[model samples]
Target: MNPPKRPGRRAVCLLVLFSVWWVAVATVGFSAETVSSEPQVKAAFLINFAKYADWPSNAFEKANSPIVLGVMGDNKVSEELQKVIAGRVINGREIVLKRANSIDEAGACHILFISNAEQQHTPTVLDQVKGHVLTVGESPEFLEKGGVINLVRKDQKIALEVNLTAADKAQIKISSKLLSVATLVKGKAN
Candidate 1:
């Protein structure tokens, strides 16, 4: 069956805005979209990441709420993430984005995207999130630092590196389908 048509002026506006961002990023050096596709690709990755990940029961405070993606810094990425997950649902839970200034402020997030600019505190951030949240980041050393997913820019597109053992330790399941396209690291083949 064919998919339903997307709705409304706001949707169109968002698309246009992102297309501009995508083009600009593709043309410019590593800005926000240079490393990631602003909100669009990031959100898509987050949602798709959810599909690839399995959270144990009780991962959410309420089974019915949307899974929260906690972004622990101020950056263009966070703005995009909020826009992208605006009205989506994940595993019967609605998708939400929460901003955190400090790791301690970031409670109850299922996925955490650590902006590359926050490298100084990555170790502590990872420590705070370990075994609870699936972490994604742009830092190359993220995996080495114990983060689960390292998002990299290759040929101007976002690629992924995953640590299966870390993910498993977080009680998160990685889909073999997703793994097929990702660079698996530091663990047995998924």
Candidate 2:
């Protein structure tokens, strides 16, 4: 009888890659029961952003400091984000959601989701938070204005637009698994 053949190295590598990609997509993508509103989807993105991102050591007060996600300009998004992240811990740090009253207040957060309601103040807000936090906005001019990441709407589907240069300048390291699914963009250098 012929001996059973083992999977080749290339096959193993492909399997590993596929598993990682599946976990990333499955966790962020909408499941049947959770299939709901746009705000909830954005909230899921925010939660996964914390998972697939690496912040500078000094960004936190200590090893145990909570990672804060601040939301500005839309009450629905903030509420949704809070509901999704409650009792969850990310990167060994507790996840906390804050409804920011102003752009200045959000500057201190680890991830800031600037809602479409704040569209008019995009430039100014981006200027204030540049190189400070991960900024996710839905506007077309968001990444051009120095946001680290933007959630773009294309072909009636939600996609991620990443500004690698902006993220590098901010000292943030986004995982390759996350970048693989993003539409990369170049940001204006300082």
Candidate 3:
């Protein structure tokens, strides 16, 4: 008789990430597209992270204010996110996608995404938005630059690297479920 089999570690990890990704996508009604680049995936993660993180009341100007994603120095991610966020509301607030060219512009958002294109200005931007924004980045040195959550590539797939110190400083409370799937870091840097 053949033995019963369980899922492998890699399969289980993929399943968890995929399930979170799917639920996030479903919440925003993200349309299925033939994504051609990493930007799209990062956009998805940005939305997913936004759903999982909680910010202070001051992050929003009003109770009905939008949850804004201020994407810095990358139009592709911004554009793809616009599609996913179009007319979507979460926790009774609308989702707004925007592009930012400077730290000042990025500071006004609930969620800030710093692209590799803006790597040189990451420190300044991270400093500007500290204690309020849910910061996400695609660069390897993002968490080191004082960002909260950084997306990384592992085994040819995208994974999450979370800096709890940064998140705590930013006052963004990330769900334990989200943290369970991430590579957690401590004490400001990885």
Candidate 4:
């Protein structure tokens, strides 16, 4: 049997930096009411999340299928994500972005980012993608509604809340490294 490869010094350093940043965001609440939009930063986080999540073998259509990131509503975030993912690859799969308008469209995506514009239809979206996709949203309500991850703006910085129950139901495995930095929660959005 082969032994697991340990992380290199550089990887450990990066992990430490990420952990510190997450701790700062989680512990020290942002105090500012209004700050500049951070779509680019959010987009970066989304990409990194893909690297830290494990999907079922059937999630992709084929061995060489690309990881499809579907954006439903919020053109700005979609555009930002598209720009960041351009030519990027995760787990040997190229990253692709798609604008989705319906549940069926979103079901084909590996990661579905539901924007505030689609807030009203969150339930339907979640139902459609349940057990097959990683659903991300920007509101606490999303976590309540069975979303796997919620990106919230605290004060001015971004914070994460993960729904482990939802992820387990969907058969997705979120890395321990990612969970170490996120505030874990569980429930259906009311």
Best by TM-score: 2
Global Cα RMSD, each model? 10.8, 7.4, 8.9, 11.3
Q: What residue runs in model 2 are displaced by over 4 Å at the alpha carbon?
A: 1-33
- Prediction 2 TM-score vs. true: 0.79
For 1-190, candidate 1 gives per-residue lDDT tens digits of 2343657666777788899999987777656445554456766786678777878877766668577787866467777776677778766777777876666655467888888778888888777653468888778788888788988878878888999888887888888888888998784212
- Model 1 has an lDDT value of 0.75
Poorest lDDT segment (10 consecutive residues) of candidate 1: 1-10
| Model 2 global lDDT (CA atoms, 0 to 1) | 0.83
Full-model lDDT for every candidate: 0.75, 0.83, 0.81, 0.83
Cα-based lDDT at residue 123, candidate 1: 83
When summed lDDT is taken over every stretch of 10 residues in candidate 4, the lowest stretch is 27-36
Q: For model 4, how does the per-residue alpha-carbon lDDT over 120-153 read when each residue is reduced to its tens digit?
A: 8988888766446889998768988889999998
Query: Could you tally the backbone clashes for each prediction?
Result: 2, 0, 0, 3
> lDDT (0-100) at residue 23 of candidate 1?
90
Give the residue spans of candidate 3 off by over 4 A. 1-36, 187-190
Question: Which lDDT tens digits does candidate 2 get at residues 51-84?
Answer: 8889999989999899889888988888888787
